[model samples]
Target: MASRLAQLEGPIDTVYADIYNESGLRKETTLSKELGFKGKLIVHPAQIKIVNEVFTPSKSEVEQARKIIDAAHKAEKQGKGVVNLDGKMIDLPVIKQAEAILEYYNRLVINNQ
Candidate 1:
């Protein structure tokens, strides 16, 4: 399903792991994150908090994203479009993904505040 979504030319921003049980949902959320899912689908209102907490990027993740974005920007300022971030070459696509993650994290923080 994730592969199919990636094959589409248009963007598929989020994927939901349709689940209900607490522990099951927690496990599913973890797998979904590994699979690049940005949200979860829940059947009950009680699942809302769990889903949100699971989907929100962790503090460490947000910090990593900030570092990636900063590195990319620094590279761009130096007339280089690609950067080696922790031994991996980061270009436009990687930078875009980092930007997206930070954007989502920022939105969540703003909404919570």
Candidate 2:
């Protein structure tokens, strides 16, 4: 199953309702996240909530992302845009990742309302 999953995973980042029902969608979302799928697809836009829930970073992740962007911004103000976070490099890319997640969540909230 792992081999087959890895094979299909890359090409099928977007899931299908035909392949999965509402309950299956929920399961697939969890499986996809475990398999490294960033998001899922839905025949109707209504499935966005499930996908959003599956893909949305956890509270801790959101906080870390926010911190990364904040620190990046501070570095930029100092004429820098890179540093080391827990021995890992923090740069514009990291900031962009954070911004992308925040934007995604914000969009979901706005559109789902």
Candidate 3:
């Protein structure tokens, strides 16, 4: 499992573990984080709150994503392929990525109902 996770993308924040085995739970959570899982895991309903608390992005993350999208759109209107944002060069692709994050975040919020 660890080996598989290593080949995946950054900031992966989820893992599934058996609820009955405390040791396994600990091992999985530890390895999940060490392997870059932020705070998501598969468990019983009793554990949903904990997993969500661990995985949800903070206010600052939402703010950053919004700013990135805004800057990217402004750059696009200016016929610029890339623009500087907080010292980083961001192009349309980067803006699209940030937009996707917001979309995904919205989906999560919507489906949670």
Candidate 4:
């Protein structure tokens, strides 16, 4: 069900994890993140930390997103519509995704600070 939800291109912001079980919450949150759910519903304050941790982009992900944005900018400057990074083609959709990731990461940083 989570996998199917991930397939939807529309925004997903209402998935809920097990509120009574911490372990179950962790697992469910992690799986939801891996499956591309944007956010999860949490009934308890304790669930906030785990849910945020699962959804937050990692250091490596931020770095990769920066690289993708840089590569895309370079390609744009060169009048090219696509670029290659780490031997993989970086197209518009990939660039957009990377930009979105960075945007979300930046928001997290700002909010946390």
Ranked candidates (TM-score, high to low): 4, 1, 3, 2
Q: Write the per-residue lDDT of candidate 1 for residues 1-113, one digit (tens) a residue.
A: 65646674222233334545678777777777777666665666877877788878889888888989999889989999899999999988888878888988888886779
TM-score of each: 0.75, 0.59, 0.61, 0.79
Clashes of 1: 0
On lDDT, the stronger of 2 and 4 is 4
Indicate the residue-level lDDT of 54 in model 2.
Answer: 74
Q: Give the TM-score of candidate 1.
A: 0.75
Q: Give the CA lDDT, 0 to 100, for residue 30 in model 1.
A: 78
> Which scores greater on lDDT, model 1 or model 3?
1
Pairwise lDDT winner, candidates 3 and 4: 4
- Residue-by-residue lDDT tens digits, candidate 3, 44-104: 8755655554445556767788999999879888998899999998877788767866876
Which portions of model 4 miss their true places by more than 4 Å?
1-17
Model 3 clash pairs are 12-37, 13-38, 14-40
What TM-score does candidate 4 reach? Answer: 0.79
Write candidate 4's Cα lDDT for 1-113 as tens digits.
65456665434556454666878777877777777777787777878888888888989999999999999999999999999999999999899899989989988876779
Superposed by TM-score, candidate 3 places the C-alpha of residue 49 at a distance from the truth, in angstroms, of 1.2
lDDT of 3 at 17: 53
Query: Alpha carbon lDDT of residue 32, candidate 2?
Result: 85
Candidate number achieving the greatest lDDT relative to the actual structure: 4
TM-score winner between candidates 2 and 3: 3
Clashing pairs in 2: 15-41
Q: In order, what lDDT does every prediction score?
A: 0.76, 0.73, 0.67, 0.82
